[model samples]
Target: MPLSQSEVLAGLAEIVNDETGISADAVALEKSFVDDLDIDSISMMTIVVNAEDKFGVKIPDEEVKNLITVGDAVNFIVGAQG
Candidate 1:
């Protein structure tokens, strides 16, 4: 079965936690990496790399920076897979 958007977002939260040492639960759909998570550019890059590895797809930098929410990441992954 295909993963749901929430599931993908949850997985992304886990990946983000693994990379940034933050709590996965803290990442919400409305949360911004800069304002909410206080994530730096390097950590964001790590997120992009980890996400690519996790989803087996390359996320372009433009898309990476635009991922402001869990739903955004989920949508991106779904689109990439499609």
Candidate 2:
């Protein structure tokens, strides 16, 4: 079954937290992975890979650039699931 936005966000938050030690609660939809979360490219890549595994979605390297915010990633995963 496909996951909800909130569900995806929550899971992503956990992945971010695990990778970067950032709090899950602080990972809101509007927050940018770079500017807001202070995440570097390497960390972002790790997060993306972990998210792909956790969500069972394949996020291509070309498309990773477009996922700027937490919401963007969540939306992509949701859409990919469908």
Best by TM-score: 2
TM per candidate: 0.85, 0.97
Model 2: per-residue Cα lDDT over 53-75, one tens digit each: 99999999999999999999999
In order, the Cα lDDT scores of the candidates are 0.82, 0.95
Query: What tens digits encode model 1's per-residue C-alpha lDDT throughout 26-58?
Result: 988778888888988898898888888888777
TM-score of 1: 0.85
For candidate 2, the per-residue lDDT at 64 reads 95
Candidate 2 colliding pairs = none
Of the candidates shown, which would achieve the greatest lDDT relative to the real structure? Answer: 2
Candidate 2 TM-score, true structure as reference? 0.97
